[model samples]
Target: MQIYPAFHIDKKITDAADEALRKAQPALKRIDEVTDYNQQKMLAAFIHCGVSESHFAASTGYGYGDRGREVLDQVYAQALGAEDALVRYNFVSGTHALTVALFGVLRPGDTMLCVTGLPYDTLQSVIGLTGDGNGSLKEYGIHYRQVDLKKDGTPDYEAIEHAVQPDTKMVYIQRSRGYSLRPSLFVEDIEKIAAIAKRRAPNCIVMVDNCYGEFVQKEEPVAHGADLMAGSLIKNPGGGVAPTGGYIAGRKDLVESCSYRLTTPGTGREIGCTLGNNRELFMGAFHAPHVTGEALKTAVFTSALFEELGYAVTPRWDEPRADIIQAVLLRTREALIAFCQGIQKGSPVDSFVLPEPWGMPGYDCQVIMAAGTFTLGASVELSADAPLRAPWAVWMQGGLNFHSARLGSMLAAQSMLEKGFLG
Candidate 1:
C-alpha cells in the first residue's frame, strides 16, 4: 500500500499499525461488538440539546427537586471518575460551560491569563475579540492576556509565567486547537502548564477546554493536575450516546463554584432541581471511551493515508495523535470540495446531498459542512470542513466505527485517483 507524505509514518510505525489492525479485524468482525453506524447517524439527527430527552420524557415523580440533583451528581461522578464532577445537561454549549466555570471562579477585575493564545473560534467572540455585538468575558470585566504557542503547538511556559500578574485569578488552557492558528496541545503540555500554574500561583485556577481532545489521550487534564476541565457534550465526551450536553470536571471547590454559576446562584452546590436527560447523558458517558478510541484510530489511519498521497497533514502522526482531527491541505478549492463531497456521500447524514460553502451567522466568511443538519456537533459520521484560506485545507473529523472510517478513507483515495490527482 502507498503511504501518505504529510504523515511521515515510517516502516516501523506502519508495521505496528498494520499488526494492530490485523489483530483488531477479527474482534471487529463480530457485528454485536459494535454499534450500527446508521443508527448512530439517526440518533445524531434528533438530539438538539442535552436536554431534549428531558423535554420529552415523562417526569419520573422527580421534580426539579433533590432527587433530580442527586441523579445528575451520580451520573457525573460515574462518567468522569472525579469525585466532584459537575455534569449539567442544561449548559447550552461548551463555551457556556467554560464561561460559567470562569465566571464562578474569577471575581470581577481579576485577570484570566490565556495560557493558550486565542481559544477556539466560537470562543473568540466570547473572549471579546470584536464584541461582534455578543456578551463575553470582557463584558464581565475579566481581564485577559495571551501566550503564543511553541513550535510544536504547545504553550510557552516561560511566556505564560511572564504573563501572570498578581491579580491573575485563572490560567486558561485549551487542549483542542479550537479554531486557532496553532495545533492541538498534547497531554504532557497540559501537565507542564499545570505545573507552572501551581508553582507560580497555587491559588490561581488551571482550566482546560477539553473539547475534541477528551478521551483521545490516555490521561485527562484532571489526572495531570489541572484544577478544572470542560468540554462539549456534542463532541468526544458525548460518545454518540449523549443526545446533547457538556461537562466540567475537576477539584471540588472549583467545580462547586462552576455548578453554582451554571444554575442560579446558591443552586450550584447540587445538580439544580432542574430536569435533565440523565439516561442519555449516562449512556453517552458509558460509551465515550470506546467511541473516542475508534475516532482516534480513524484519524490516524486517514492522516497516514493522505500524507502518503503527498498531501500536507497537520499534527502528522510522527508522535501520538493529540485528537481525532486530521487536516489535509488540498491547496486548491476544487480538490477540497471534491474531497468533502466524497466523505459526505459515505456519511449517513444526507448521503445523497452535496455540501457547498455558504455564509453562516457569527462568522466572518462562508463555512461548509457535510453532515446531518444539527447544531450541537453530534454528527459522528465521517465529514470534512474547511474555512476559505490560501492553499485551502480541508479538515476531516469523526467516524463512529473504524471500519466505516477505513472505507471512507479508501473512497476518498478513489475519488482522488479518479481526478488523476494522485499521480
Candidate 2:
C-alpha cells in the first residue's frame, strides 16, 4: 500500500507520520506473534468441529436437530479454551448476549459485582443501574455495584478485596475500555482479579466481557482466570465477515445454563437454526486471526500518527494492546468534531455527509460517530466514536487493510491541522 503518495492531504504531516510508523517497526513485528497464536487456536477449533459444507444448511421448526448450530458452539468453545459455548443468532446484539449471560447465572437473591468502573452505557439499563426497567436484572431482584478504577486507570485491587461481599455471586470484569479513559484490561489483570475473587468469594463466578478484545492477545482472559467470557460476532471475533451473532464461552455448567436462557431449559443447545449463517461464522472464524492482526497494525499506525502531531493518545503506540481501540485526545470540541468529520470524509460509504455530536441512545451526553463501512456499525471495520466530554478525544479503530487505514489516519490528522487544532 502506498503510504504517502495518493491521499490529497498535507505532505509534511504525512511525511512525519510515515517516519513515526517507521519508528514503530518493533511493535509492528509483534502483530505477527499475536496473529500466529490466534491462528493456532482458530485452526484447532475448526479441526475439532470437522466443519464441512453440509453444516451451512439452515434448520427450521423449533430448530431441533441442527448439526451446524451444535458444531458452531463447539467451535467457539474450543477457540476460547472453554468447556462449552453458546453461539447464537438469537442474540441480536452484544448487550443481548451479556444480558443472557448475566440473567442465566445469577438468581433473584444474588449480587453482581462489577470490578471495573461503570460498564458501557448500553449495559446501564440492562443492569438497572439507572432506569428501573422491568426486565432488568435489578428489577428481578439481583443486586449490583461497581468499583471505579484508580487514577491510573487500573482496577482498584484494594477496593475489590473490600467489596467482595459473601453474597457477590459474580465478579464482572470488562476487558475492553468501553468508552472509558482507562486502558483495556490485559490477561494478567484478569488473572489478578480472578485470584482475588477465588480467595475472597470462593463460590463466586468470574466473567470477562471480551468485546473488542478477542484475538489481539496470545492468551484469552478465560485462559488466565475468568470462568466465563462473552463477545459479539460483529466485533473482533466476527472478523468483519459474520452478518450477525454473539458468543458465550466458559465452564460447561455455566454455558449450559446460558444456553438454557438462550433457548429454553429443556431444549438447551438442542435447538436454534444456523439458518445459512454457518458459512459466515466458519469463514469469519477462519479469517479472524489475520483480520485482527490487520486491525492491530492499523491501531499502531493511528497511535503513532496522532502522537506525532502533538496530540495525547491512549495506549500509546508502544504499549501492549489488549483490544483494537486507539484513542486520540483532540483536547477541544471543534477539533473532535473535525476529526470525526475527517473519518466520515474518508469513509467508503456516506462520505459526503457530516457527523456531529447529538443525543444518541444508550449515552447520557451527545456523541459523535463516523463510519463508512460496508457493514453497518461494525467496530471491526474502520470507525471512530467519542462522547462530548472533556479533552475531546475520539477513539478510532478497525481498518480492513493497511492502505485504507493509512489513508484514513492521515486524513484525520490533516483535518485537525487544517482546523488549526495542532501545533
Candidate 3:
C-alpha cells in the first residue's frame, strides 16, 4: 500500500527534510532567477515566430507546411543558444538524435575522437564496438578513437592534445557522467575542452551529447563552443510535459545537416509534421527551467541526506551541479536493490511495484531502472537507474516536486535499513 505523507509520514525524516529545504533556500532562489531568464528567452522565440492556436494541429504526408514545426525549432534554438535547431517528435530518444547529428556531419573514412573518456554505453553499438552487424558507423568506414579521462576522472588534456589530428572530423564530449563515477561536466569544463579542440583541429566539429544536462544551468554547451548538441525531449528540455521527442541544436549548417539526416537528402527541415504535439512542446520548453530547478533541489537534498547517513555521494551536496543526477555509491548489490525498491514505494505511478535488475539491452550488464514517471520514460519527471556492475552505484535524477522526491529518498533509506544493508 502507498504511504501518504498527509497522515502516515515519518516525523523524524520529514523534520530533517524541512531543515534541508531551509538550507537549500538560497540555491533554490538562484535557480529561480536563471529559470526566469531562460523562460523569457524561450517566450521571445515563440513570439518572434508568431505562434498561433492552429500551430498545434497535426499534419500528415511529408508534413509539408507545418508552422508549429518551424516555431518549435526556433524556440529550441534560442533556448539552447544555438543558431538553429531541430525539435521533433520523430527522432525518438537522445541516442537517436545524437546518431543523426554524428551521421550528418561525419562522412566515410572520417575519424571521430572522444575527449571525455568513454561515452554513454548506448553509443558503443552505434559506433560499431558492438551490434555492428547492421549499418553502424564503423561499417560505413568511420574511425573511432578515445582519450580516456585521467585517473582522477578529469579530462585527459595531454591525450586530447595528441589525439585531435587532421583526420579527426568530429570531437565528442559527453556532458553527463552516464554510468560513470566522474562528475558531470559544467559549461566551464565544456569550454576548456572545446577550446583545445578548436585550436588543435580547427575544422573538426565539436559535438556534445547533451542528455540530462539541459536547463539545470542557465547557459548550454552550445554557448561554450560546441558546434552541435543533442538531447531527448523526455529528459530536461521537455519540462516533464512533452510525451516524446528529441532535439538537435547548434550552428545553422550543422543543425540543417542533422535535419537532413533526420528526414532525407532533399527533405531536411521542411518535412516532419508536428503531429499534434506542438502544444506540449511549447509548454514543456516554457516549464523546463522551473521543473529543472525542482529536480536540482531534490538532488541537493538527496546528496545531503545520504552523506549524513555515512555513505559517500559523487559531486557532494554543495558541489557545482550541472545536472539533476545524484549518484550514491552503495557498494553492495543488496543495498542497491533495496535503495531503488524504496524509491519505488514513493512513486505515484507504480508505488506497489518492485524494481529488479535485468539484462537491459544496449548495456553490458544487468541494469536496474526505477522509472515511475508520468510520461513513460521521462527522466525529468523523477527516475533512477544504474547498471548492476562493479561500482554498485545508484543513479537518481529528477523530481517533479522536492517533497515527493524527498519521500522517495527517505523510503529508499528505510528499505536499505530493513534489508540490514544499513541500520
RMSD (Cα, Å) of candidate 1? 7.5
By summed lDDT, the worst window of 10 consecutive residues in model 2 runs over 1-10
Model 2 lDDT tens row, 223-247: 8989988888888888888878889
Preferred candidate (lDDT higher): 1 or 2: 2
1-423 per-residue lDDT for model 1 (tens digits): 345554333454355446545544443433223324422432442342232334334233324444434545555554454557776666777888887787778876888888887676677777787545256778878778888878867678889877776557888888876444367877788888888887788788888888788766555777777888887777777777676677788888888878777765675654343444766665676567677767766776776667766777876644356667878888787777777777766665576787788886556767777664233356444667877655577777777787766656655655655665665
Could you say which candidate leads in TM-score? 2
Clashing pairs in 3: none
Off by over 4 Å in 2: 1-6
Tens digit per residue, CA lDDT, model 3, 113-154: 998888899988999988853788999999899999988888
Badly placed stretches (over 4 Å) of model 3 are: 1-12, 15-19
* Candidate 3 displacement at residue 251 in angstroms: 0.9
lDDT of 2 at 172: 97
Model 2 reaches what TM-score against the true structure? Answer: 0.97
| C-alpha lDDT score of every prediction, in listed order | 0.67, 0.86, 0.85
